[model samples]
Target: MKRSKTSKSWMNEHVSDIFVRQAQSDGYRSRAAYKLIEANEKFKLLEKGMVVVDLGAAPGSWCQVINNAIGSQGKIFALDLLEMHPIKNVDFIQGDFRDELVLHELENKLNDLKVDLVISDMAPNISGIKTKDQAGIIHLNELALDFAINWMKPNGNFLVKSFIGEQYESFIEAARVVFTRVTTFKPKSSRDRSAEIFIVGQKIKNIEQLNDFGLE
Candidate 1:
């Protein structure tokens, strides 16, 4: 089968991408690992022995990064709708985290450990239909945030990938309401042409208080 020009162009660019080459040489599962590394550099989000939850963690590059950053003492509860090959220290749950059974299994694995960071690299499979893709990503972002609020340690952090769109500011505002500090930036590993940006929420406000205000 003949490849579309777009697919051929993308393959060429991906092959030449510095991050891609580095990921291949560095034993990271994918180029996405650098995004988490850069975010951590700026936010000081990861620390040795801290507990974490990773959403949409297929391919496990971010999981590898987390495992290295936090070490053996740290715990990682990771979930995705897709299967991920095992990473030595990552506790992976392969299922839709939205399902009650899946969530229960993840919680069971967590064993009530308070998560110091909740990071999501989750993005919906793009169908090239702008409206549908945007809605799907937004829903995933919301679910990640809600799960973070319930599971995070006091002053824990939340980071998620997002794309620029009509509802973007509203989501930022929503995160700000839950976290004392909220900011968004594009990591160096993210493609310049991509609209993707990461939202970081630091020093969470009291979850109980958020519930009292119905913010949760």
Candidate 2:
């Protein structure tokens, strides 16, 4: 079957993206790696010996970035509904993050250690429905926030991909109550026409305080 014009255009753009070319040269799995790298550069999130979680980690790009940034001393637990090729120094959990069993497995991996950082690059399969896509992004962001509240250290940081529509402002406001600092970041690797932005929440004080913030 012939590809639609839109699909062909998207393919062309994806093939020619500078980040994509750079990823190939740098031995990264995907261009998405640069997004995390750029965000970390801005927020100073990743560090040596820190425990981190990568939610919705597929194709292992973000996992690769985290592993490289944190080095061998740090540990990374990555989860995704889709199968991801294994990356060195990352514990890969293949399952839906929303499932209780998967969540339990993640907690088990922690083994009493609080996470230093939680990064989520989850996005729903685009359906060409803007409102639905936006809602899906918001829902994933909420889930990532919940994980941060439950599993993160007092000063842990969270970086999540969110769409800038509908719940965007309210979500940032809600994040502020749990985190001492909250900011939205759009990396240069992110396409200019894309609505996606990274929300960085830092210094989570107490999980109980999240209830007051209404993100629980």
Candidate 3:
């Protein structure tokens, strides 16, 4: 089958992308690793012996970044709906993150280990319909937030990708209420045309203060 113009253009751009070339030479799985690298540089979030949860971690680029930053002492729990090749120390879970059973299995794998950081690069599969895409991404962001609230260690941080849209303010407000500080970042690695931004919520408040945003 002939590739659509969009797909062909994406392929061309991917080939020409500096970050893509850098990722290839650096032995990372994808260019997405640079986003996490830039975010961590600014926030100083990853530590040598922390436990982390990576939602939508397919291709395992972010997991690679986490693995390098945290070293062998740290633990990574990575979840994705699609299959991912194993990363040396990452515990990969294949399932829909929203499903009750998947959540149970992930928690079981964690064995009640408190997560020191939760990062999500999840975005809905784009259908090119703006409203629907926005809604879907927001829902994923909420799920990421809920997971952080439930599983985070005291003073843990949550970093998630979010798009600028009608839901943006409400989402930031919601995060502010639960975290001691909430800030937004647009990594240089993210395309200039893309509206995607990272929302970093640091120093979480008590879980008792959380409003029902869907938690187990």
Candidate 4:
């Protein structure tokens, strides 16, 4: 099969990326593993026996990082639209996170367990249209934020991938309403040319007060 010029270029770039080579040498599932690791190092979000929810965790790289960090003491629940092979100490749910059935399944699996952290690496399928892609990415970030507010315990944390664009301000503002502190981070592993950045919202506050603070 013939690949598009863009696809071929992307493949070539992926092959040449230092992080890609590093991930392979380190036995991580994907290069994205380092992004989470970098974020965790800066934030100190992971702890023993803490419950974590990973949204859009297909390919399981982020889950792998979390699993290693939490070890046998913590639990990790992951959901995605695509299937992922099982990883030890990580519960995998293969389905669209936005679907009611999938959400219920995750909730059931959670079983009254409060999440200590929620991490989302979800990205929209790019159509080469910057505006549309940004909108989709922003929407996904909002959904992840909603999950964090509802499912996370007080003082919990949320780490989500977002795009840098005109829509970014509103997104950060919304995040600030629910979390005591919110910061934007661009991991070294993230491509410099890419507009993608991670938003880390820490010390989740009272959900009831979120609305008053301007968060939906």
Q: Tell me the tens digit of each residue's lDDT in model 3 across 1-216.
A: 999999999999999999999999999999999999999999999999889999999999999999998999999999999999999889999999878899899999988699999999989888989989989889889888888888889899999999989798899998887789999999999999898999999998875666444333
Residue pairs in candidate 1 whose N, alpha carbon or C atoms collide under 3 angstroms: none
lDDT of 1 by residue, 1-216 (tens): 999999999999999999999999999989999999999999999999989899999999999999898999998888999999988888899998668898889888877688999999889889988888888888888888988888888999999999888688889988988999999989888999887899999999986869876966
Which residue pairs collide in model 4, if any? none
| Residue-level error in angstroms, candidate 3, position 102 | 0.8
lDDT of 2 by residue, 1-216 (tens): 999999999999988999999999999888999999898888999898889999989998888888887899999999999998888888989998878898899889888988999989999988989899988889889888888888888799999999988988888987888899999889999999988898999899675676665555
Residue 116 CA error for candidate 4 (Å)?
0.3
TM-score rank order: 1, 3, 2, 4
Show the lowest summed lDDT stretch of 10 residues, model 1.
Answer: 207-216
The lDDT of each candidate is 0.90, 0.88, 0.91, 0.90
Clashing pairs in 3: none
Model 1: residues >4 Å from true position, as ranges? 1-3
Higher lDDT: candidate 1 or 2?
A: 1
Give the Cα error of residue 214 in candidate 3, in Å: 12
Candidate 2 C-alpha error for residue 145, in Å: 0.6
In order of appearance, the predictions have TM-scores of 0.94, 0.92, 0.93, 0.92
lDDT assessment of candidate 2? 0.88
Total clashing pairs in model 1: 0
Model 3 lDDT at residue 191: 91
